[model samples]
Target chain A: MADDQICPKCGAPLPADVAPGHCPKCLMQVGFESQDQAVADPAEAPTAVSGHSGVTWDLDQLASLFPELEIIKQVGIGGMGVVYQARQKQLDRFVAVKLVRPDLCDDPTFSERFTREARAMARLSHPAIINVFDFGQREQFYFFIMEFVDGTNLRQLMQSEGLDATQALAVVPQICEALQYAHDEGIVHRDIKPENILVDTKGRIKIADFGLAKLINPEATDFTLTGAKQVMGTPHYMAPEQLERPLEVDHRADIYSLGVVIYEMLTGELPLGRFSSPSEKVQIDVRLDEVVLRALQKEPEKRYQQVSGIKTDIEAVSASPTGHSPRQSVVPPTVRQAFNNLQYPGYGLYCVVNC
Target chain B: MDDAGFPSPHSGRFATTRWSIVQAAGVQATPNSRHALEELCATYWYPLYAYVRRRGYQADDAQDLTQSFVLSLLERNAVQRADPDRGRFRSFLLGSLNKFLSDETRKQGAQKRGGDRKILSINVDDVENRYQLEPTDDITPEAVFERRWALTVLDAALTRLQGDYERVGKLPLFEALRGHIGADKSTIPNREVAESLSMQEGAVKVAAHRLRQEYRDALRAEIAQTVTNSKELDDELTGLFQTLSGT
Candidate 1:
C-alpha cells in the first residue's frame, strides 16, 4: 500500500500530488481522516481469511478437519471437487467424502449452495440414492460424507460388457426407482447420464453424486446463458426440451434423460435423430419402443409426466416373464393411466415387480 | 483433472455471472448483444487509455488512439479471437491494446476516429486530469495499465458501496466511516464515530462491522467481474497490489 497514498478504495495509487482526497482512478472520496473504522463480523465470515489459502490440504489438515474419520484413500475427483474413501471411526464403516476445492472454500454463496444440496440429499431416505453419512462445513472446505458404494459404476460395467436387454431391465428399473423417489420428493437430478449411474460388484444400483451438479452447473448454466449457446449434458442423452427451453426444466427432464439412459443401455446407442428403436438395435421387446420413445420425447408434456410412469412400464416389461406379450399397444392412454394403480410410487411394487 | 471427474478450479462464481457474459459477448457480439460489450468497453477504456498515454503518446493522440482502438477492435470483430475460458479480460484487453499500438505505430500519423457512434463516453479533460495523478518516470506502460485497471475495478466497487449507502440514505455514515473501511480503528475510538453518527458506541461497532462485510463482498464481486476462474482471482488480486506499488 506504499502507493496507497494513491487510494485504497480504488486500488488507485493516484499521484501523491493530486488534490489530496479525491480518488483520481474511480473519482471517489479518499485520504480523508475520518475516525470511523470497519469492524469484522466474526459470525458472518465463517473462516479466518488468513488460514484459507492452501492449494491442497495436507494430510494433517484433513485429519484435523474430520478427527473421527481415518483418511484412508483418494477415491476420485469430479468437475466440482475431490472424493476420498474414508472410514468413519465410530461406525467402522467406509464412506466416500467429497471435499469442495480449496479455492472455492472462500465463496460464501458456493458454501451456502453446497449446504443446500447436502440438505436436499439428506431429506431422501431411499437406499438406491447414495446415503449421506455426514456433511458440514469445517476448517475451510465443505465435505459431504456419503455411503461409498464398493462397486464399479454402470459406465465401467458397460465398458467391460455392455448390459443386455434383460440386464438393463433389471438395472434401469432400479434407477427409475431412485429417480421416482427423488422426483416425488421434488428433486431433479438434472445431469442423469451413464456416468452418474453406479453399479456395485454385487449388482446393487446406487445413484451416486446427487447434488454434485449444482456447483458444476455453473459451467453449464454459463454456456446456456452465454454465446456457447450449448446446454450442459452429454448432448446425446439430454432431453431436447432441456436445450430448447432450459429454464422450464423440471422433474420430467430427469425422466427424459433417464429414457436416454435406457436407450443407451438397451441399444448401446444414444436416441439421436431418427434413432432406431431399442428393439431394432438389438433383440428386445418392441413394446419398449413405446416406453423409450415416450420418455425421450421432445416435448416435456409428451414425455413421462412422472418418473414412476417409466418405472411402471419398465417393471411391467420385466414382470411379463418373457413371451407374455402384454399388447403391442404400449403407449399408455393418459399420464395417470400410464402409472395406473401404482400405489406408493416406485418404492415397493416397482422393486418387487422387477425383483 | 483427477479420477472422479473434477474439472480444474470449477470457474467458481458462474459463467452466467457478469464477467462471463462480457467475455461471451466479446467473442461474437451481435447488434443486439453489442451493448453488453460496449458496457464493458466503457468501464475499462480508461486503463487502456492511461496505458497508451504512458506509452509516450501525447494527450490528444493517446485519446484518439484509445477510442479508435477500442471501436476498431469491436468494429473489426478482432476481439472475437479471445477465448474467455482460456484467458482473462485484462490480459486479453492489454494484449489487444498493445497490438493496436504497434499496428498504429507502423501505420504512423493519426487514424480517423468515427464521430458517429461514441461507444465509450470517455470525458477527455476528466481522463487527462485523472492521468495527472499517476506517478512519473518510474513504471512501464504495461505496469501502469495494470495499476490503472486495478484501480478502476477498485473504484467500481467503492462506487457501488457509495451508491448502496446513498440509496439507503446513509451517505453521511459512509462518508464518515469510509476512511477506515479496512484500516485499524484503535487510534480513533468508536466513541468518536458514535458521537458523530449520534449512535451508541456498540451500535457504531456493529455498523462498522456490517460495512466491512459489505465492502468485502463488494470487492469480491467486483474482482469476480475481472476473473473467470477462482485460480485467476488470487493471481489478479496479487498482481493488483504489486502493480499499484509500481512493481
Candidate 2:
C-alpha cells in the first residue's frame, strides 16, 4: 500500500523497489518508453513589473500599505487601478495588488460599493475566481490583495493562439463553476469578458473583478443609488436588460455575458459588435446561435433562467457533433469562414476578439 | 473526478436539519444518515460552550451542561426532528443548546448526574494550540473556537493523507515532499538534497515525481471528504488553498 509501490497506470499493488509507477506490462504492450520528462520548465520565474513599467509608484510607501508584503514594483493598468507585483511576507508568496484609482476612491458611493462587492466576491469560494485576501484603505489609496495569478489573461491567451476547441473546452467548466457559485450567492457579475478572466499557469480559469456585483438581499440601503438605478459595467457584453433597467436585472445578465464569451471563443469574433449586418458576418452554427441569441434577448424573462442552464446548453453543444462550432443563426457562414482563415497568432483568437 | 461514492457538498453535504426530519417523518432512520446532526454540533460547539460558561458555571459545571445537552440530543434522537426543508441547523442547534444551558443552570448541581460520558471526542491539545497561535490581545475564546474548527479540518485533511502515505511506507518521503508545493522560490541546489538523502539526482527526480503524485492523491482525498459531490471538488480545493494562504 506504499505510495511508491502502487502502479500509477493500473492502480495495482507492487513492491516499492520494483514498481516503476507505470504498469510495466502496459508500457510493453504500447511500446512506450517512460520519458518522465519535465514539461517545459515552468515559464521563467515571474519577474517584478517586467510587464508593467509604464506606471510608477513609491515602493517604500506602497510596501507600508501592505505591511505583510514586500512591494516589488508597479506592474500594469487597465480600466481598473494600477497592478503591483508584491511578495506576501508571512506566506512567502507573491500576489497581485489592485489599488483603486485615486479619483475613484474619493467617491464615497464608489468606495462603499467596492467594499460591498469585494466582500461578496470574497464569499464566493470557487476555483475559477481569483482569491481576494484582504481589502483596505491606506494613505488615500484603497487596495485589495489578490492571488498573483501567474500566466496571461484570456485576452492575452486568445491574442496569440486563437482558441481551438480543446482550449475552449478546458476553460468552459471553470467559468461555469465560478458563475454558478456567484449566482447561487445572489451576486450578479455585471462584467464577464476575456480581460476579466485569467488563466493561471496550470490552465485553470480565474475570474477577476466582481467590483460591479449587487447583492440580491443587501444588508444596508442602497449607498450609490441615482434615482433608484446604478449605471455601471462594460457595454459590449452587457445584457439587454442591463441596458434598459440596471438595478432590477438579476443573474441572467451574467448568462448573457457568458454567451458573448462562448460566441467569441467559437467564431473568433464578437456577435454584437459594429457589423454591417450581424448575420452577414460569421458562420453561426445553429444550436450555438440559438443559445447566444436567446441569452441576448432584450427581456430578462426571455433569457436563460439560471446560469447553470446556460452551462448545460454549453456542455451539450460541446458534447454534440459540432463540438462548440458557432451555430449559423447569429454567426453568418461567411464570417465563420473568415474567422477560420485568421490563424491564432500565439495566444488565441478569442482573447483578441474579446479584449 | 468520480461521483458514485463521493459526497455532494451542496445539495446534502451539510443537509439542512429540516430536510432530514421531513424525510424521517415519524420513523427512525439509520444512524449513518445523522451526519447533518453531527456537523451542526461540531461546527457550533464553541458558541454553545460560550453560552454555557457565560451563564456563570464552574469548569465542571460547564462540562456537565455540555454533556447533558449532547445526551439529551442522543436520547431524543433530535436529528430526526431536523426538518431541513423547514429550518436551518444553525437556528435549531442554537435553540436546543440554549434550552439545555438554561435548564442546567436552574438545577444548581446538574454536574452530578446522568451526563458524565464524553459526548465529543475533541482534542483539547489541538484547541489550545490554536488558541496560542492567535494574537494574544485580539482573540477571545469564541474566536479561538472558530479558529480551532478551521484547523481541525486542516488537521483532518493532513492526517488522512499522512495515513495513506504511511500505509505505503512512503510517510518519511512525504514529510520531505510536502514543502515542495508552496515554499519560497529559493534555489535548492539539487546536489545538496541528493547528497543528504544518499541518493543520485536522477533518483531524486523519480522520488519527486512519486511524491507529487502522492500529494495530489492526498489533496484530492482530503477535498473529497468535505464535499459530497465530485463536481465541487475543484472549488473546495481552491478554498483549501485560499484558507491556508489567507487569500
Candidate 3:
C-alpha cells in the first residue's frame, strides 16, 4: 500500500490522488514530444519494447566508423553507404564524404573495382564534374570524398516545378562538357539520369556521381543512392542499348540519357513515343530538334558517337533564334521496342506524367 | 570502493533515493542529512571519474581534479540547489561536473583543489586499469558521459542479479546461461545448457527466460534511480544499449 505512494520517475512520494497520466514534475517538464504531454502510462512498458527496438538505429555511430571526419549532418543516404556533410578536421575543409555500407564492400572483387573506379574518378578534375577530392577505406566501410555542391539535384528542381528554357539550356551544355571529359578519360557514367546532375546555388551545373552505378550494382544498394524509387521512371531516360545489352554500353549511352534529360526539362514530360520534340512541348529554340533526336537514336553507334559532338550540336542550337519550326525527322520503329525492354514499370510513370 | 558500506539502495528507503533525498533535504543540508548526500555521491561518482579521465587528463591529474571537484561540490552544496523536477540526477551531476571542470581550468590546473584536503576516497589507483578496458575510439565528452552512466547502470544490475541468483543457490544455473544471454537461439544450443545444468531442455529455456526477466527488472530498478521519471528510463536505456553495441 505504501509502495503505490512513491513516484516512479524521481522516486519521491507521489502526491495523493494526482491525475493518472502526467508526472506533475518530469513529463510536464519538457516542451518536448507530444507523447510526453499525453501521459500514456508505461504500465504496459515491456509489451512496448518490441515496437521500440529500432531506437538504436541512427547515423550517430559514425563517430567511431569515421574518426578523422566529424559528421556535421547527414546529407543523403544511398545503397553504398551514407553521404555525410563533414569537416575533415586534419585538412579543415568542408566535404561531402560518401561512405558505402559495409555489406556492399564485402566482396574482394567489388572492393578492387571500387578502388579502380574511385581512382579513375579522382583523377577526373573538371569544373563541370563534381571534383573527387580523395577516397579510400575508413574502417570496414569505404568512403569517397568530393567537393560538396551547395545546390539541389536536377530531379528535385524539375520535379518541384520545371526549369526555365534558358536555365535548361545552360545546364545541358555543361553536362555535355562533363560527360565529354569523362568519356575522354574512358570512364562512362552508366547512370546519367537527371538525378545524377546537380545545379548549384550559382546555377553552375555539374555532373554528379559518375562511375558509382558501374562500380556497384544499383539493385543491391540503398534506394536513396540508387534512385530506385525515382528510377521507376529511369527507363524513360535510359538509352536503348543500355537497356537491351547493358554490358556493351559505352560513353554514347550517356549521350542518349542526356538527350532524354533535355527532352524532359524543356517539356516537363518524358520523351516517350507519340511525343513531340523539345520545342513542341515548350517554346525552346527549334534547332534543338535534330540534336535531341539524334542523341535519342535506337542504336548507340547511330547516336552522337562522342559527347563532344552532342556539345557542338547544343552550342549550335543555342546560337539559333527561338520560335522557328524544327525540320521533320522520321520516327524510328526500334526506339519504341527498346523502350519496353527497359525493365522498369515506366508505362505507369509516363501515364501519370502525360495525364 | 564497492557500495557495501552504504545502506542497500533497494531496501524500501529507495523512497529516499538520491533524487528524493536532495528534494527532501533542500538547500540547507543538516549534519543528519549528510549521510544520504554521501550515499548519493557514493553511488554516482565513478561515471564522473570516468568522464574527467576521458577529458584527456592523465592519471594523477584526473584523480586530483575529480577529488577536488567532488570536494568543491560538497563544500558548495551544489546538490541541495539542484531542482529535482527539472531533470535526471545523472544529468545534474554531469552538468555540475562540466561547470566545475570549466571553472577549474580558469582557476588553473591541480593547485590545492581539494578544499581543506578532504579525503573523498575515489579508488583512482584502480581507475586507470579499469579505464584501459574501455573502447579506445574517438568519442565526445557528451557521449562518454552517456556511455559511462549506462555502463554503470548495467554493471549495477548485473551485480545485483548475480547476488540474487547466488542467494537462491542457483549460482551455477546463472553462470551456465550467462554466456548465452547475449547469444541468439542459433548460437546457443538449449541442449548444451540442459546437459550442463542437468535439466530438461525445456526447463533450461524457462530458466533462461526467468534470468532474462529478472535481469530486465534489475535494470529497470537501476535506471529508475538516476532518471526524473519513468518516461525517461527507456530513453536512457536506449542510449546505453547504443553505446554498448557500438563496438
Candidate 3 TM-score, true structure as reference: 0.45
Candidate 3, superposed: residue stretches over 4 Å from native: A1-57, A218-234, A324-355, B1-247
DockQ for model 1 equals 0.04
lDDT score of residue A296 within candidate 2: 57
Error of 3 at B133 (Å): 54
Give per-residue CA lDDT, model 2, range A192-271, as digits (tens).
87778877645678898774334221321332342212233444566655545555667887887887777677667665
Distance from true position, residue B66, model 2, in Å?
Answer: 85
State in Å the error of residue B92, model 1. Answer: 44
Correct interface contacts retained, every candidate: 0.08, 0.00, 0.00
In model 1, state the lDDT of residue A25: 34
Docking level of model 1: incorrect
Selected candidate, larger DockQ, 1 vs 3: 1
TM-score per model for chain B alone? 0.85, 0.56, 0.79
Q: What is the TM-score of each candidate against the true structure?
A: 0.44, 0.43, 0.45
**Candidate 3 residue pairs in backbone clash:** A9-B228, A9-B229, A78-A225, A79-A221, A79-A222, A80-A100, A80-A101, A81-A100, A81-A101
The clash numbers for all candidates, in the given order, read 13, 43, 9
Query: What tens digits encode model 2's per-residue C-alpha lDDT throughout B1-247?
Result: 1111111121112321323432453246455445544544554455455545545555556656766676566556765555454343434555566556556453444455534565676444443343333433344443433333333444444566576556444576556544442221132233566676665543444355434433344444443544434445555455444432233
> Whose DockQ is greatest here?
1
DockQ-wise, the better of 1 and 2 is 1
Candidate closest to the true structure, highest lDDT: 1
Candidate 2: list runs displaced more than 4 Å. Answer: A1-56, A109-111, A213-231, A273-285, A322-355, B1-247
What overall lDDT goes with each candidate model?
Answer: 0.63, 0.52, 0.60
DockQ-superior candidate, 2 or 3: 3
Q: Is candidate 2 or candidate 3 better by lDDT?
A: 3
